[model samples]
Target: MADPVAAVAALDEPNRRKLYDLVARATCPISKDEAAAAVDLPRTTAAFHLDKLVEMGLLTVVHERRTGRSGPGAGRPAKLYRRSDEQIAVSLPDRRYEAASHLVTDALVEAEQTGEPARVILNRRAYEWGADLAGQAAEADASRGPASNRVTEALARFGFEPLAEGGSILLRNCPFHSLAHRHTELVCGMNLCLISGLLDGIEASGVTAHLDPSPGHCCVRISQAPSSRSPSVSR
Candidate 1:
């Protein structure tokens, strides 16, 4: 996978960014000479920046003969540049809306084929995915300390930004922020199921996941189970 941060940083230079835009907008790959002329830069300068973009995985290079000739007389193939197929995204707080979108799409398709409710399918799939993630983490490292710590580590790995506060785990960032805002009930319910599955897969005890929405935070919160909560005694 291409590092999105590096890809974005590669465009920070003015000439490089311009060259990238020019090549991306073109219908076909562009040669170094064409790119230099279009950007009003020297050929060497343009080539340097273009190659840098290629190094950063923002652009891909191809060598093809501009002149339609197959014999030895045909000069060395021209170095052509074009936008890469790699998808680069950088989101603050590390949202995973793309994953959520895929899950929803799969749920809709499965519901149509199996004649099941979309909501039910989505929740079940999300739960299974969460459990799979936990299982993978456990397999990666068996000795991950206590259940709470393991759960927090898994949540953080998935970009939930879990924060341990008092006896509850408050998710500081929602991996599906925009979608949750638009489809509050559906997305939140899916998220709850996912976390619940993670907890179950890891065999977490005395902790229950629930919907506890607040401004600027995930809709779901993990807190002490009702039976595990201790009553306050009068002094």
Candidate 2:
């Protein structure tokens, strides 16, 4: 996993950020020579910055014979750089909009097929998805295999950013922040059901999910016992 802080720090340099922009905007991989010319920098400077980006996991490199010439004089292969698939997010505290996207999209599809209310389908599917994800994680980590471990990892992988807080795992980020802000009732409801399903899927007898909304924190929090307190999301 790429360190979020380090990834953001790498782009703090002006020239490095410029070079990254060039490569990212390009239709295809760019060479050091091309990048330098585009940014009005020397070949060596561009190469240095490009390599730095690669090291930071912001870009990927490949050796390409771009000339399309075949002979002893074909010359050395050119080094090319392109944007990496790695996602770099530096949300203050942390947030997970992508996870929300996955849940909402899947719910939409499921609703279309079943001819059911979107919210209801979202509730059911979110739990099923969490359970399915836990199963996959368990299979992938057969060695240290405990359902809780797998569940924790799966949540982290989805950018939940779970952190220990007072005998509870406080979710530090809500992947669906914008949606939650606009449709607090609907989104938080989906979130609660989704996490509840996650706990069920993992067979986590030791922990339970609770709806605990706080400013700048995830709406759902995981605690050792299910709380009688139910958080109301405005519909």
> Which candidate wins on TM-score?
1
lDDT of 2 by residue, 1-235 (tens): 3687898898999999999999999999988999999999999998999998888889999887998987799999888999999888777645667777777788788779988777777777666766776677666666746655655776776677888777788877887778889998788888887777666666677687777899878898888765333222221
TM-score of 2: 0.70
Clashes of each: 0, 2
How well does candidate 1 match the true structure, expressed as C-alpha RMSD? Answer: 6.5
Estimated TM-score per prediction?
A: 0.76, 0.70
Name the runs in model 2 displaced over 4 angstroms: 37-42, 71-76, 85-87, 132-173, 212-218, 221-235
Number of clashes found in candidate 1: 0
Residues forming the 10-long window of minimal summed lDDT in candidate 1: 226-235
